[model samples]
Target chain A: MILEASDISFSYGSHQVLEDVNLQLKPGMTAIIGPNAAGKSTLLKCLSGMLRPKGKVRLEGITLTTLKQEQLTRQISFLPQEFNTTAVLTVYETVLLGRVHQLGWRVSDVDTRIVNQLMQEMKLTDIADRYLNELSGGQRQLVAIAQSLAREPSVLLLDEPTSNLDLRRQYEVCTLIRRLTDSRGISTALAVHDLNLASRYADWVYVIQNGKLRCGGEPQSVLTETLIAEVYGVEARVTIGQETRPVITVLGPVPVASSDFQSERDAGNDV
Target chain B: MQGTTANDLNQAYERLGRRRLAVVVTVVMLVLVSLFLDVITGPAALSLPEVLTALFQPGSVSEATQTIVCTFRLPTALMAVFVGASLGIAGAEMQTILNNPLASPYTLGVSAAASFGAALALVLGSGMLAWTTTVFVPVSAFVCAMFCSLSIFAIGRIRGASTETIIVGGVALHFIFSSGVAFLQYMASEDTLAAIVFWIFGTLQGANWQKLAIIAVVMAVTTGLLMSRVWQLTALRLGESHARSLGINTERLRLQTLILVSILTATAVCFTGAIGFIGLLAPHLARILVGEDQRYFIPLSALSGAFLVSVAALITKLLIPGTIFPIGIATAAIGAPCFAALALWKRRSYW
Candidate 1:
């Protein structure tokens, strides 16, 4: 396991957000899926060392709490959901900030090479000189991914990487993340809201509900109609695709009052 | 990959080289101009050649010109440069750490607290409490400034405070300190009252070699120390959580930076009274010139601040034929309008 959490629990004062969570992650793409307020992002924060957990996190035989921050950063790169840069930094300069973990004060020749290569690979070369605020949502997402990849960390933690992208851009970002993981053998853990996207891309899926892990396995095993209905409080149907992955479709909630519908129909007839 | 890497490397070098060249040229030109202009300012008219000869060879010029250049004008000019640089760098550090454009030493109530401490010392007389007041006026000022900053920081650390909350807290603290100084001024003796008032208005007239030496050594050492931590400061610009993920002890950095800024501000205030706006203006000027890279911003801000103060002093000296105005008045007169213009211009661009 590249990262492992043992009986991790956390709370904001008396309100518990995560309870007795145990997780072990290996070198692959693991999608964390859940309803809102399920502590998916919180777990990711703990794993990425952004927040301290109640229990221990161990990575490569060293306890995470004991390791220096910079050392951990060298191995793990985290992309938060939102960021604001007050400085009018260009795309290239912003991405180069990712390399700050490796290069301290001065930028070396190798650092420049890595940043440039990442920019080209991310298809941001044309707009590299443009300020960050000038970019579209999808373009900014791409630049953000490029920045996360700048340090060339062993693991990448992304919090809803595709949340802000449109349908087409969503696929493009997921594909890029998938390719980076597969080709470079980089470990990735993504918190995703879109179940279908998670099902299509995730090698492993962990379902979380009410701050506890509900299920953890392959996408086909973890993503089911019963689990979805129970966790999300919505009626949904799941169909297994030809590719052997599940697709979920939300149906309208079970009708509770026929009288209200009849009254609406009578009112329409009167009009 | 190798070819592309080489090309990128070359481009990075060229960009860095151009920026470095621009900064170097600007700094050198500004320093030369400031030095020449500063030497010729004073009531006793001495030509540039006479000032230079007096400076180089003390016996070459008359006693009056020599005393005027070396004792009065030179010390004031140097003090202006040192004090201005301290304010500029402190402002840059404050803004970066707070992650707010409006965060300056003054905005954070650092200068106000320093002024309050100075006022207290002057009104109560340094002899009242020998250890606390007399020997430690600067130390007391430093303590008060740090206290004010820490309070503002604590207010911001409260969950759900937008940047505006901290700014509001700073403004409130400013009013509190200003009122405190006013209270002190109310009860001061006639002799000490004039001195206190003049001090509050700020003047370089009391600038002497001993004081200038203290200001220079303190400002240079503090600025240099802070400059060495530019990488850490840059990481900090990403916010505390992000900085911690990058292996920085964010709280520790904050504490250290707060102390450094307070010390710098206290040192300047102890010597030059309460000179406003240098810290506010210099950092903005440096940011415009050097981009937001703190490594370049730190030193550039220092140099630009020195140039600004020196120039301001010179202009104030030459403004009237026979009368000398306080440096603080001239700086405020110039700084306020420039600040207004910049605000209007930056309104659309500031995010």
Candidate 2:
């Protein structure tokens, strides 16, 4: 296993976000899929060392919290769901910042070479000189990913990497992530909202609901209709496609209690 | 992949380099001009050549000229530079730490707290309240500033308040301190009341070697400490969780920076009284010139602040041919317009 979390628990004051969570990520893509309030992002934060847990998160047999910052940063690269650039930095300069842990103030030749190559790989060489604020959402996301990869970490943690992107950009970003995992054999854990995207790309899936792991297996076995309806409070149809991936479609509105129906109807009639 | 675009890239690089070089040159020129202007503006209006001669050959000058140029004017000018630089760096650090574009030292209530402490010292007197005013003015100011900042930090931490909340907190604290000082002024003797008012507006009339030495040492040490943490500060711009993931102790870093900024602001306020707006304006000027990298931002803010204050002091001295205005008045008069211009420029950029 490249990354492992054992009996992890976390809370924000009285609200428990994660409890007794155990996970193992091998050198492939693992998608943590769940509804908004599920402990998916929280668990990823603990594993990535962004948040501390009561138990242990070990990467390559070494405890994450005990490791030095430079060592941990070199080992794991985390791309947050939202970030703002204070300066109008060029793509190259922003990407170069990823090497700050390894290369202090002075940028080495190797650092520049890696940044240039990543920019090319992400198809960002064309806009490398453009300021971060000038780029479109898709272009900015690509630059952000390239920044994460510039560290060349063994483990990558991304939260909602495609949330703000359109459909084509979403597919493009996911494809890029898939290529990085397969070609470099880097272990990746992404908390994704689009279940179809997760089912299509993830080598393994962990279904979480209400701070507990509901199920874990290959996408085909784990994304069942009952699980979707139970967790999301929605009626959904789940079918295994010819490509061996699960296809989820929302069928209708969730059933509401009679009281809720009467109030909604009254409000609607008034409108 | 190869022809005009490659040429465009090369041209862009060249343009950026040239622009950066121009900014550097302009800053250097401004510093020199400010320094020179500071030397010439005093009771005895010496020519530029006479000013240079007096500076190089101090013993050759008459006792009155020597006292006017070296003892009185030079110390005041140096204090302006140091105060300006410290405030500028403090403002920049506050903005970066809070991740708020509008955050400044004043926005965190550091200046207000410092003014309150200074007012307490002036009204109560060091002789009567030795513990609170004499030995503890800066300390009390620092503690109050830190306390107020922590409150704002906590509020933001819970619901994750925006930059606007921090600014509002600062404004509220400003009013609170203003009322506290006003109450003290109302109860005090006429002489003591006048002194408190002067302190609030700020002045460099009492500049001395001891004050200059203290300011110099604090500015140097604080700037050095912040410079070393440039990388960590850069990581912090990514957000606290992101910073923690990179192995940085986010809480510890934030605490350390807050203490440093509080100390720097309090110390300056202790000597120069409550000089406002330099902390808010200087950092913006530095950012515009040096980009957002803390490595450049910290030093550039210091230099730019020093230059701005020095220029203000010079202008204040020159405005009244026979007398000098308080450096604080000049700073506000100059800083307010610059701030207005920055706001306008920002609005234009948005459009």
User: In terms of DockQ, which candidate is strongest?
Assistant: 1
CAPRI grade of model 1? acceptable
Interface RMSD of the candidates, in order: 3.0, 3.9
**What is the alpha-carbon lDDT of model 2 when measured against the actual structure?**
0.77
lDDT of 1 by residue, B1-351 (tens): 646654764576568647766885789688668966787767887888899899899998899888998998788777888888888888888777777777787777777887787777776663565553334555666667778877877887788765578888988998899899888888877766676677777777778888888888888788778877777787677655556656677777876887788778777876676777877787777776666667778877777777877877887788897777777777777777877888888775654
**Candidate 1's TM-score on the B chain:** 0.89
What is each candidate's DockQ, to 2 decimals?
A: 0.37, 0.31
Deviation in Å, model 1, residue B142 alpha carbon: 4.4
For B11-93, candidate 2 gives per-residue lDDT tens digits of 55457656765776677678777876776777776776666667889888778777877888778777887888888898888
Deviation in Å, model 2, residue A43 alpha carbon: 1.7
**Candidate 1, backbone clash total:** 2
Give per-residue CA lDDT, model 2, range A1-271, as digits (tens): 3899899999999999998898899999999999898988788888888789999999989999888777888888888777555554677767777877766655566776677667766777778777766777767777777888888888989888888788987888899889989988999989998989999999999988889888898999888877776667666899888588999998765566433544665788998
Choose the strongest candidate by lDDT: 1
Q: How close is candidate 2 to the true structure, as a TM-score?
A: 0.86
